[model samples]
Target: MGRLIYDGEHRPIVLDDRTLAHLKVVVTTKLRRHEGFTMSWRHPDNQPRGRSTIWLHPSIPLKFIFDAPEPPELNQRWIQDLMDSANSSGGIALVDEVIDGPQ
Candidate 1:
């Protein structure tokens, strides 16, 4: 599991390495362009049943930590989906990754 620490907060948002990796790309890209957005995600099975959203701004401090030393392979379609949501009024919603085609 990877942890996303935001704004020097005590509680780190836990996410799988793959999801975090994809998010890091989209988030950094947006921040680099000076665009702030909100990111929402449903709590995983390990956490209490609830949803959480965070505002990401260029001035805020964000950190992404992965358990594995090597980064996971990114899904372009998934990244595009995330980017689309980030540009929407609702902002980015952390959903499960979609496979390209047949399993």
Candidate 2:
């Protein structure tokens, strides 16, 4: 598990290491370009109703912390899907991580 600390909030948004890693990439890319966008995600614990969305800006302070020391292998397809969403008018939509298994 990993935590995304946004805007110096007391509570951090929890996410899996793999998902967080990929998000870090996508988010940093957009922020570097001074682009602000909305990011939405379903509650992993399914608590307090459905989903939540937040506006991410380059000026905001964001941190990513992973429990594991080493990063996990990434799926290129998943990254592409996330990138597509981030580039959309609606902005970034975080979906469940897709694990590519051996055929």
Candidate 3:
């Protein structure tokens, strides 16, 4: 698991390591360009039902923490999909990880 600490919140949002890694790339890229957007994700099984969305901005304090010592390999297709979502008028919506293999 990985943790995304936002705005100095006491509790961090937990995400699977792979998902967090991809999110880190998208989030950082947007923030670096001083672009702000909304990010939405469904709650995990242990958490409440429904979904959550947050407005991410360059000024906010955000941190990405990975359980593994090293970062996971990224999927370019997935990154492009995520960037598409981020650029959409509806904002960024988290999608399932895209595995590289015959379907």
Candidate 4:
């Protein structure tokens, strides 16, 4: 199992290679298209921080793209939506749900 660390706190969450791969597609495609959006999420077992919001945009100083593998089904409309939202002034939006998958 991989851990989701918020700011500095660590919470346990399941993260499989497939999930990481899918996430990579969702994020990178958005960045490449110049869309902007926000994602809010709370890691399971990490109630201390409550919730976290990430501004998904190319202009942001942080990058989660380099950390994941590309997904095969990255051409879905949802992917486009993510990219569009990420590119727009509104930025991409996401809600956090602790991944519960293989270790």
Instruction: Locate the minimum summed-lDDT window of 10 residues in model 1.
Output: 94-103
- Per lDDT, the best of the predicted structures is 1
Candidate 3: residue 21 lDDT (0-100) = 95
Estimate, for each residue in 1-56, the C-alpha lDDT of model 3 and write its tens digit.
99999999998989989989998899999999999999998888998898988999
Q: On residues 1-103, what C-alpha lDDT tens digit does candidate 1 reach at each position? A: 9999999999999998999999999999999999999999998888899999999999999999999999988899999999999999999998678897776
List the pairs of residues colliding in candidate 1.
none
RMSD of each: 1.4, 1.6, 1.3, 7.6
TM-score per candidate, chains pooled? 0.94, 0.89, 0.94, 0.46
Which structure is stronger by TM-score: 2 or 4? 2
lDDT of 2 by residue, 1-103 (tens): 8999999998899988989999988999899999999999887665786888889999899999999999887788888888899999988899766777899
The alpha-carbon lDDT assigned to residue 30 of candidate 3 equals 95
Predicted candidate 4 versus true structure: per-residue lDDT over 29-60, tens digit per residue = 66678866565445447356575566556765
How many angstroms is residue 2 displaced in model 1 relative to the true structure, after the best TM-score fit?
Answer: 0.5
Report how far residue 54 has shifted in candidate 1, in Å: 0.8
Residue 47 of candidate 1: its Cα lDDT?
Answer: 88
* lDDT minimum window of 10 residues, candidate 4: 1-10
